[model samples]
Target: MTVPTLSALATQLTSYNPDSLSVADAQQLIRDYVQATDSSETVGLNDALCRVLSEDVISPINVPAHDNSAMDGYAFRGSDLGVEAVMFKVVGTAFAGHKHEGPVNTGECVRIMTGAVMPADCDTVVPQELVTSASEASMTLAPGVVRPGDNRRLKGEDLMAGKSALRKGKTLHAADLGLLASLGIGQIPVQRRLRVAVFSTGDELRNIGEHLDEGCIYDSNRYTIRAMLTRLGCDVLDMGIVKDDRESLEAALRTACESADAIVTSGGVSVGEADFTREMMAKLGEVAFWKLAMRPGRPMAFGRIASNGKSAYLFGLPGNPVAVMVTFYFFARDALLRMMGGTKDSTPLIQAASQTAIRKKPGRTEYQRGILSMDANGNPQVRVTGSQGSGILRSMSEANCMIILHHEQGNVNAGDPVNVVLFDGLC
Candidate 1:
């Protein structure tokens, strides 16, 4: 059977839900797309931060390897201690990164520091703070403090042998590397990154170094899209800006498909006399354009364009700078993330109290650019950042949070409980 056009396939995909699909449905769509993607292996540990682990890592040995002192103290046999102050000779010394093979008898003690292995026959460590002194012969414990097991770490108490230390599908971070290092692991297997191509189309667009004309604006969508893609851990192929010509846009999109896993574009998908993105999608692959019930971002498109048996999905965002950003975050971000083996939990939601008065008439959900702050009670409160127009990119930059006004809602008074989106920590 002949495959349908990109637009037709989008219709098929969206036939299940169209108007006001819940965040759950959107996330499921992403998961379905991700499950359809190919997986590959990569040798990445240092550069794999924020990437998910492709395999489970078993511990080669026990964590800590041996019983050690958890503090600077004296290691002694608890059974040898009397109800009164325990007396024992300090036969040897052990510090962090150092261990003594010497045995500590019932009447003998050994000076042991944090990370130092407890000598044979020593069941407990008394920190020097609770001890009178440390000597080669014997040490005396103070009358109070320092329990019997105080400052002592038992063998395999933290990590046991043959146990799974890190599970598959776990996202690696700085702390993960430390966990690997503690297990004597230097390298790890990680999933390969999805290569992506990003571009924006419009004749009214101008690049850096070129003077802006009366009707043109500097290309801001490209930078913003690139940054967001990087955050999702995709290797971005910046295709730069293409003119309104169909051939130029088609070639750029084709190259992205051939060399990358996906192609992301902002602008040119909307209805206009000069918009070639819709025409290109018609000729190249199956595409879907949805007029989302959202402010700033409404015309969102997604589909796959094939080239030489390899196909990369495409995401067409709005041309308005702020709209492009908001749409990308809410819609395209998770799809791209899923392509890279990630699962977005749900649609963007945040907890914040309304600080100022908010007036609205909503048949569609509105994301009002907002700034969130802590009230005197330390409760998070948010206020809208002036204008909610999609073309106002500065408003997005001015605000750090997004007040997600639900559909079928009216004006809100101050101190009302409202849902918000905390992006880039501006809230």
Candidate 2:
């Protein structure tokens, strides 16, 4: 895949300049430039949860080797039914994992259990509950009780032989394990987990459990980034806090580039005289510093950097508590997912009514933290958490969804519909 230069990417954009790129444009640029890591390993199905597949899985045989009964009932030929009640002699019983020795003749039925192979001459199964009367020798069925092929599981009904069961780049879920087990698959080829090194750079930052000075604050970004990386199945290297200086920053970047597939640093990306992180990043590799058209995370740096011929994707996020999360979610999250060889492109967004009025500008995109719940009328509604400041981590903590206000959208009135992305979803 060809990675276009920043200038070439700018030429393709007609709406904005590279310096002031929109959120959508930046996301697209990152997606185009970042490629999947080509590394794979075989893992047993029991241990492959949350792992992305490396190759398409084709079934070697039909899921169900034979036509079977879907319920415990009497299996009979459909041609034997009549207007009045029909009586049939029960020739024999068929249990699961056991088949009848011979086929049943007309007016004769075989007692069958769920998953029992259907007799050669039987075309339908009437569930035991639906059979009004039954005895050791015979059973009785009404005229409208069953139709042809009803309650019968056909051969290969779940999966056919020589057909693709799961595709490459798919993240295996619980149900996927069940399906693979049904196909008699034991081990699967999957992509290796991505290695991501994360750290915070600031002289005023201290680690948790450390004594804090008058101007120092605990470094939360590293812990936050590590937690998020762990959730994404990445092997995280937490480098702790690197003081804001030329040598320390350069050393950290070099070490990360040499060891990790991706590097994430929070703080010192904005335009400040003390912010030497950006300068050191440019010295190491070709990185683009942009003033994004988005709130809470306006200044960010993104590009590929290398040290000792080893390269890694770099994401320089902002310093604020909430801004780090917002930028990471909107920009770095999907990029890292792609680099992990995942096929899932993006998270789905839902539309919900705003419970209260919201003030906004139209030039930049805003990701407001919101609590989604049912309204008085039992409809989906969302309301913004108080104080939508970039530094307020409480807003994000309280939010179950992020109410997305687009770049071209304006102030919203109460009861207005807005787009939202949920944090929790059904497994």
Candidate 3:
């Protein structure tokens, strides 16, 4: 069968199979279109945290290395249960980092601290809290204990030698740092961080600390965009704000194209007298300005910004603060991550029942800002925050989730189920 070209796919999408695509459908489309392109290289362990792993990490030895005490206590053979801590001579001392290299003789035990290797004759650990220390060599035990392997991390239990530990594409976390350090991994293969350029347009917008003229608001979208880019592990270039004039806009565009892997802009995407993005974009490269069937952020422009032997992307989002956030989360955010070679693009999603009634005009998809609180059962109960206007920056601050309302859907009463996209986990 002949594979459809990107041109053919574009033609097909022009008449989108309006099967009334859900948020998941849009997400999958983006996943399929973009392949991770970031190159990989080995970096020191200190620099590898939070970086995407480019290869599987195999363990050279079992975690814990040997059976070890998980508590600071007595390590004894479980069969010797009833004896009053049983007068077993503490044949050796086992500190956490330093372990005695010999086995405990039968009927004898060791005073073991947490993480100390368990003696070969020992199969259990009795907590130090439960025992009364009679001498430096031994302790008196308390009864009421029942089984073997208590308070102990078994040899090869947490991890096995030569086994795959963290796989390729896993993003390292703080906990993973411990695991990597335990394995003595001095360096790791990780993908490069993304390089993104951010800017804004509009003569009505003023830079921060600048005296505001009548009808001018500080150009906050650029800062917000750059900050969010940094959160997503991008190396952000603050391209600053430009006026709606074609020359300045063109220069800014060229600068972004020349230096960065992606450029994000706010304003000039909407259809209006001052919107110059459409014309400037057409002159640069193949750009798709979509009239998305969505509210607050319906006008989105996406395309490639190309130069000699290099290419980057352009994302033109709506200038309104809420619209900028919603559009970024729904579009540019995930795509940029994928393009940067990160494994996951989409944020985690779950369903929640709305706590209040919402009225919606049919046709446009809406993302109503909401606060999500947990119910007794731990399920998220969502309540809409005030004023669903796209221009309301206050609402965005008050909201923790973007409670999604479907296209052509209206009059959602309280207790109705809605999709709440949580805001905190994107990065």
Best by lDDT: 2
Each model's Cα RMSD: 3.7, 1.9, 3.4
lDDT of 3 at 80: 78
| Residue pairs of candidate 1 with colliding backbone atoms | 5-286, 6-285, 6-286, 6-287, 7-287, 88-138, 88-139, 89-137, 89-138, 90-137
Candidate 1 lDDT (Cα, 0 to 1): 0.76
TM-score of each: 0.86, 0.95, 0.87
How would you encode candidate 1's per-residue C-alpha lDDT over 89-168 as one tens digit per residue? 77889878777876667788888888998888887888777777656676788655565676788888888889998887
- Candidate lDDT scores, in order, read 0.76, 0.89, 0.78
Q: What local lDDT does model 2 show for residue 336?
A: 86
Error of 3 at 10 (Å): 3.3
| Backbone collision tally, model 3 | 0
Per-residue lDDT tens digits for candidate 3, residues 1-427, read 3533334445555345433333444444545555676588889888776678888999998886888888887888887777344556688788987877787776677888998887777888888777755577666665565366688898889899999888887878888878988888889888888788888899998888999999999987887788788777778888777889889988888888888888899999877987898788878876655677777787777777576666677888898988898888888887887776667645667689888889887767888898999989997799989888888888988888888887768878898888888888552
Tens digit of per-residue lDDT, candidate 2, span 252-362:
999999999999999999988889888988999988778899998998999989999999999999999889988988899888889878895568888899989999999
Task: Judge candidate 3 at residue 261 and give its lDDT.
Answer: 83
Model 2 TM: 0.95
Angstrom error at residue 245, model 3: 3.5
What's the residue-level lDDT of 71 in candidate 2? Answer: 96
Off by over 4 Å in 2: 376-378, 425-427
